[model samples]
Target: MVFSNNDEGLINKKLPKELLLRIFSFLDIVTLCRCAQISKAWNILALDGSNWQRIDLFNFQTDVEGRVVENISKRCGGFLRKLSLRGCIGVGDSSLKTFAQNCRNIEHLNLNGCTKITDSTCYSLSRFCSKLKHLDLTSCVSITNSSLKGISEGCRHLEYLNLSWCDQITKDGVEALVRGCRGLRALLLRGCTQLEDEALKHIQNYCHELVSLNLQSCSRVTDDGVVQLCRGCPRLQALCLSGCGSLTDASLTALALNCPRLQILEAARCSHLTDAGFTLLARNCHDLEKMDLEECILITDRTLTQLSIHCPKLQALVSQLLVVDLPLRDERCPATLPHYRRNLLSGRVSSIILGFRGLLVGLTWEVENLRVTVFVFGCEPNTGTQVLTQIHGQPVE
Candidate 1:
């Protein structure tokens, strides 16, 4: 068949330089570099500073010295907007400093899993990337309160900050961050066990614009701290308290009452939480889109059903509560069963199902008549009973 003019143009060898460069942007650095060697035009566009805005040198092996980063930054010129060096074991403080100095326009920087990065590197980043708005230092073990001081002093425009698993950061560092970066909207301190009530209190006091806060694994934070946070940041859309062992039902209840705009809440591993906490969430926070109650032993079908009824927008849920125990009257029961099944099939659900035998052993008056069996499965197509199964005397698959 004869091709139309448009089709001919598509198959034409000659293409506009801008279009070719735009296409090159989608290619990986290695592939782009290889294409650059094919022709002069490709080389010009590939090496152009405009196309080098986001540099992902993750896992790129090089010498421990600053030569690799320095060379890359120098070659990319000053147009680098985002620099992600995650899992780059070869890079140290010297290399990071070199990049920071050259890429002053960088807005998003991820040094996650970079264990070699010390406070000195973070300090250098604050000094160099004054315009940086997003910084992810997750798993950067060397960063301390001193680094926060530097970050607060320099990166005042920061909007998003993730220091998850940074064990060194204490209340002092968090306070400094809150005091310095008033514009910060999202803060993830998951696994920062050293963080306490004082740090969250500072966030509530200074970071009024905060939209998302994650304090998962921060065992030191108590109900008082969460109460303070909910009372202060009313506009908060997302709040994560997974593994925060000290948090009780009262804190969640207060949060539900206070944070009406809360869209996402993750209270996984919060052993202190009970049905009362979920009831509070159901009564309020109707806009919730995501909730995680994994390992919350106190949560039953009753709370899950209540959450489904209240939070129609809920799209994600991670919980240990059995679907079979939830009252069928709950509108969310059908939806939740499917979600649970999907998570189970995908291996995303981390909590183990406590056997009926274990429950029977734990209960004082439980007899043979008590039917308790937990089946982990994704929701079947068009069938709401994704979590249902018949237990017989003999084991059957």
Candidate 2:
């Protein structure tokens, strides 16, 4: 287009090539498509290799087809680092294979909920994307032990692998991964229904560098499996045995003695766990920060007291206390209050924001025919001169 001195086009052309490309780089993939259609200069700037470091197809329309994926992959070439194709059901094994072949430098790949992909796609990914480190295959139901063969052989650098709800994989595949990918740090096998003690034993035997292990909903994993696994994985920082109801105090006792580095442990719905096991954990695992023991009927206030005293790092506790719904009624019960140690700035401790004194009150509620009293401790749960005495499922006025 012809332009005078005041023309916007004339002014934009006067800008340096570096400045033009830098401006184009800020545009997202969809916006870049529009930029490419504007003019020849903008088209060249949009396709520049630096502008395509990350391609997340989840940002685009649901109908992103195989040709679109192939074109994007070709444009990216070897520059792609992070590619998220989460829920991109229109594209499958063929398009993903094309991507894996071109983007060799890819590190993080999120293919969560891509139902059309099978073991062949995983094989292609392993053969081509050798630099792959993080992979999320959550809900890829077609994925089986055959996929592990590809991952085990080539994806040696893989550290974080999430196979959550990929129910097709079994003990054989899991065991192969543990043995082959010794560098595996975080492996999530939640809802792999066929997995049992056999896979846990394999993990215990081989996966030593593991820090986070999620065996939640693996109903077959019992206390024996946990005992064996904890004995091997001493560096475990986070462990989720949620819904593993078969586990007893034996598992907790083993973890307390073995996993001193354990910080976060979630045993939600583990009805068999008792105070004896949790107390052992609190006294031993000084680095413990968060613990979930909901539905563990045997766990009482004693464990809470022990955690408050022994675990200095404990910030969040999910014991039965968090679930206790104090019904609104006129009932008085003497609560044996735990002396909560507060950070002492002066000789006396105060919850008051200002340097003044405040009134202290106690709370009493009935649960299971037993009246329990809770002496209010910690920062006052009030907002702008309001007091909240009892909080049920919903907030109180």
lDDT of 2 by residue, 1-397 (tens): 7766556666357898899878877888889989888667778888887788887888663978888878878988898899888988877899889988988999999989888889988999889998999999998899999899789988999999999999988889988887778888999988887888888889899889899999889888998889989988999999999999899999999999999999899898999888899899889998987777767877665776576567767666554542222111212322211111111111121111111112222333333333333333332223122223332332111
Note the residue pairs that clash in candidate 1: 341-377, 341-378
Summarize candidate 1's per-residue lDDT along 127-196 as a digit string, tens digits. Answer: 8999999999999888899999999999999999999999999999988988999999999998888889
Per-model C-alpha RMSD? 8.5, 8.1
What TM-score fits each model?
A: 0.78, 0.80
Off by over 4 Å in 1: 1-23, 39-42, 59-65, 326-397
Report, for every candidate in turn, its global Cα lDDT versus the true structure: 0.75, 0.75
Backbone clash count, each prediction separately: 2, 0
